[model samples]
Target: MTDQYAVLGNPVTHSRSPFIHACFARQQHQRMEYRAIEAPLDGFESCVSQFLQGDGKGVNVTVPFKEQAWRLAACRTPRAELAGAVNTLWRDESGQLWGDNTDGIGLVTDLTQNVQVKLEGARILMLGAGGAVRGVIQPLLDAGCSQLFIANRTAEKAQLLVEQFAPLLPEGVLLQGGGYTSVPSDGEFDLIINGTSASLSGDLPPVNPVIVGAHTLCYDMMYSARPTAFCQWAITHQAARAVDGLGMLVEQAAEAFLCWRGVRPDTAPVISLLRQSLA
Candidate 1:
């Protein structure tokens, strides 16, 4: 029988995961069936339990359910433990659930490999201190950025994140956090990553244009058919490049697929296909 997998989200119909995973299965010749599961807002645990009991091999958790899934897991990868959220889930031989968060590695891969942006020794600015931002901090630090600054509406939240991840910083790497208005003006950043949900509502973070220089790459962790507000803002500020999170989405899914199937599917073609579909 084909292995069964799915993506669980509250508003799951909008997820491109099933299609992306289908492409992976075909590329790797894996006998698998993937689908989108709309778990009720308060019914995530029960829904996941039912799926696993039905012989489901794995499922990608998203949005409000990631934290719940993290709590439900019998074991978690180091990254997932730091993130305090779980986006990928599967069962071990003993039927113990394992959880992992691929969002950070996905963002790092897309930026360094796909976009060819050098993260090492580069000054980076991350906007927002929510779960999306939390999931990526360790990986970004692991990438060897010389400086990483996080700015959020709630200054305390951003500070908390900085405190939480400070011990992981490598020598010579600086990590700071503050409110949007408190973003440093001493110098420009090489990269500015928008991890906020502002773009989903057509809003842009209150970052100063001075933070973006001609060589800065602005990345919004949100993708849409058209340019996102943050992308347009970056363009207007004359930044070097403004990219959406589509590549990150595909890359993260590829990582999850590898975890479940032990085969890494080539992501370039899948990214191209998804981009074309978006266009």
Candidate 2:
């Protein structure tokens, strides 16, 4: 029997997950169908329960539903536990649901493999302290960045993240957090990531433009057909590269596919196809 899978979110019609996963399934010769599911804002649990009861093999949870999925799972991977969010979910032979967060690995892979940005010894600045940022922190720290700074509008949220992840830092690495206005003025970062929702609203973070320099690489964890607000900000600041999250989205889907199918599909062509379609 062909497997059934889907991505669940509010306002999910705009999702590219179905297209991305279809490409993977086709490339890997897997017998599966992927679709988008828009769960009602307050009815996510009920919607997911119904889907699973109807023979759904797996599902990807997005936005506000990720934390709910984490709570719903019978078990979770270590990364998911650290993130306190779940993006991928599947059931075992015993019918127990398991959750995992593939966001961090996806972001790291896209930054190092796809974008060719060396994270080792790189000074990094990340915007936002929400679930998106939480999902990527441990992996970025593990990737060997020398210093990581997280800035958010509400300073306490960012500081909480710093406190939570500080113990995981490798020797010689530093992690700090504060309000956007508190971003250090002493030095520039090699990499800056916008994990905030600012791009969706076409608003830039209230950060100093000086944080971006000629050698800096800026990435927004949001993608669109046109340049994202953060991407435009990077360009305006003459940053070396301005990237949207298309690559990360595809890479994360590929990781989730691997988790479900035990096989990895090539992502470059899928990303290219999605890019062209977006255009």
Candidate 3:
């Protein structure tokens, strides 16, 4: 029987997960089926329970449901616990729910592997202090970034996030957080990551253009067929490179696939194929 998987979210009609997973399965010659599931706003728990009770083997949780999924899973990976959210879930042979967050690894892979930007000893500037930002902080810090500055609309949230993760930082890895308005007025950073939802509203968060000099690499966690507001703004400021999060999405899905099937999917081909289709 074909193993079953799905991506669960409200307003899931626009999800490309089904298509992405199908491509992955085809490339790996795996007998599996994946679909998009629309969960009611407040009915996430019931929806997941019902799906698992049936033939569903695993799910990728998105948006508002990620935190809820984290709570529902019987066990969570270290990364998921740090993120305080679960983006991937699977049932083991013992029928126990396993949770993990691949967003951090996904972001790291896209930045270092796909974009060819070295994270080691790099100065990083991250936009936003929400769940998405929280998910990726640990991995980025682990990748040997010399310093990370998290900027958000609300200063307190950023400070709280930094404090939460500060204990985990290596001796020399600097992590600081504050409002975007508090961005240092000094030098440019090696990489700038936009983890904010500002792109969804077609708005670019207020950022210091001086922080994005010609050599800075700009990455937006939001992806679209066209350049997102953040990506466009990065370009206008003459960033060395501006990339959207499409590759991150695929890479994260690949991580989830590895966790479920114990096999890593080659993401480059899938990313290229999707880009072509979008074109």
Candidate 4:
């Protein structure tokens, strides 16, 4: 039988993982079956257990269930441990459940490879203090950015993130967090990433427009058929480039695919396919 895999979550009907993984498997000529499974909101643990007991090899957990998956895993990769969540899950020969988070690597890879936005030595401003932001912090720091300031409406929430990751801060790098109003005006930001759900609801993060310099790159972690509100804000401010997370979505799925199948698929074609479909 072909190896089986899936993505699990509540309201997973709209997930593009099946299509993304299908393209990857076909590209590498791997015999695998990937699909989406919508688990009941309160039955996440039971649902995942049922799948793994069957022919399921691994499954990607999303949204509300990621934290639940993290708790259920017998082992976790360091990234997943820091994230306090798990998006990818598998098992060892001993049947011990293992979890890892590919979100940060996904975002970093997309920005560096697909978007060609340099991360090394770059000054980055990230807007958000939620789980979505937490999953990507270590990887962003690991990318060797010179400075990363995380801003949120609740200043204390952002500061908590700063404290949590302080021990892992790289040499010659500065990491800080505060309210949006606390964003520095001393220098232009090399990159601004909107990790907030503001763009999903068509709202821009409350930050000054002066942060966008001539060469600044603005990226929204949310993607839509049209420009995200943050992307529109970037364009209106004359930022050098405005990008969405579609590439990150594809790249992350590719990372999970590699974990399951041990082969990395080319992401460029999958990203192009998703963009065209979104348009």
Candidate 5:
């Protein structure tokens, strides 16, 4: 039988993961079945356990279940440990369940490789302090970002991330967190990433244009056929580039594919195909 993989979440019907993975498997000539399984909010644990114990080879957890998946795993990679969540899971031959967070690496890979953004010595302003933001902080730091200031609606939540990630900061790198008003008056940024879901509702985060310069790249973690509100704002402010997270989504799935299949898929073609579909 072909190996099975899936993304498990509540409200998973909206996920593009199955289509993307199907593209990947086809492109690589691999025999695998990937799908999305919607588990009841309270039934994530049981659903995941049942899948892994039976015929499922691996699963990708999303949204509300990532934390629960993290807790349920018998072993976790360091990145997942720091993230306090898990987006990918598999069981080894010995039956030990393994968890990992590929979000950060996926984002970093997309920015550096696909978007051609420079991370070393770059000043970044990240909007949001939630789980999506948390999973990607360390990878950004590791990518040699000179400064990362996280802005959120609630200042304390942002500060907690700053304190928690302080130890992992590369020497001479600066990391700070605060409310929207606390964003530095510093002239402009090399990059600005919006991690909030405001775009799904056609709302833009309360960000000032002062943070975006002609050299800045504005990236929204949400993807749509039309420009997201945040991306529109960035373009209106004359930022160098305004893009969505479709590439990140494809790249992350590629990382998960590599984890389960032991071979990486070429993401450029998949990304192009996905963009065309969105259009």
Candidate 6:
């Protein structure tokens, strides 16, 4: 029998996980069935329980339910524990649930491997202190970035994020948080990542365009059928490259698949298919 997997979200019809996973299974010749599951907002736990009780092998959790999945898991990976969120779930032979957050590793891989952005000793500016940013911090720091600055619309929330991540700060690797205006103009950063929900609202953060230059890489954690607002803004401001989140999505899914099946699925072709579909 084919192993069963799915991605769960409240509003799940729009999810591309089913298509993405289908591509992975076909390419890897893995016998698996993947689907998108819509669970009621308040029924996330019960829905997951039901799935587990069936032939479910694993699940990809999204958005409003990530936190709840983190709480429901019997055990969690270090990254998931640090992120306070879970996006991947699996049940062991013992019927114990395991949670992990592959979002950070996915983003890092997309940036360094796909985009060829060098992270070692690079100054990074991240826009937003929410779950997305939180999920990616450790991987970014681990990639040997010299400094990680998080700027948010609400300065206090940004500051609190820095505090929460203080333990992960490596010696000589700085982590700072503040309002966008507080970002010093000492020099242009090598990489700038947008993790804010501003793109969802068709808005860019209130940051100075001067921060972007011809050599800066601008990345938005939002993907659209066309260029996202942040990507447009980055291009208008002369960023070296403006990338959306489609690659991150595919890479994260690959990581989740690896966690469940112990085989790394190739992601480049899947990303190409997604980009073409979007185009």
What is the Å distance of residue 238 in model 4 from its true position?
A: 0.6
Evaluate model 4: give its lDDT: 0.93
Residue-wise lDDT of candidate 6 within 1-279, one digit each (tens)?
Answer: 678998999888889999999999999889999999999998999999888788889999997899999999999999999988999999988989999999999999999889989999999999999888889988899999999999999999899999988886888999999999998678888889999999888878988888788899999888989999999999998999999999999999999989988898989999999889877
Say which prediction, candidate 2 or candidate 3, comes out ahead on TM-score: 3
lDDT of 5 at 233: 93
Clashes of each: 0, 0, 0, 0, 0, 0
Better of 2 and 4 by lDDT: 2
Evaluation by TM-score, superior candidate among 1 and 2: 1
Measured by TM-score, how close is model 5 to the native structure? 0.98
lDDT of 4 by residue, 89-110 (tens): 9988999999999999999999
Error of 4 at 228 (Å): 0.7
How far out, in Å, is residue 13 in model 5? Answer: 0.7
Residue-by-residue lDDT tens digits, candidate 1, 88-159: 999988999999999999999999999999998999999999999999999999999999999999999999
Which regions of candidate 3 deviate over 4 angstroms? none
Those runs of model 5 whose alpha carbons end farther than 4 Å from true positions after fitting are: none
- Writing each residue's lDDT as its tens digit, candidate 2 over 155-210 gives 99999999999888889999999999889978789999999997777777898988
Alpha-carbon RMSD of each model = 0.7, 1.0, 0.8, 0.9, 0.8, 0.9
| lDDT on C-alpha atoms for all candidate structures | 0.94, 0.94, 0.93, 0.93, 0.93, 0.91
Off by over 4 Å in 6: none
What lDDT score is found at residue 266 in candidate 4?
96
TM-score for model 1? 0.99
Q: Per-residue lDDT of 28-124 in model 3, one digit per residue for the tens?
A: 9989999998999999988988888887889999978999999999999999999999999988899999999999999999888999999999999
Worst 10 residues of 4 by lDDT: 197-206
Candidate 5: lDDT of 203? 72
Once fitted onto the true fold, the runs of candidate 2 whose alpha carbons sit more than 4 angstroms away are: none
Alpha-carbon shift of residue 193 in model 5 (angstroms): 0.4
Q: What overall lDDT, based on C-alpha atoms, would model 1 receive against the true structure? A: 0.94
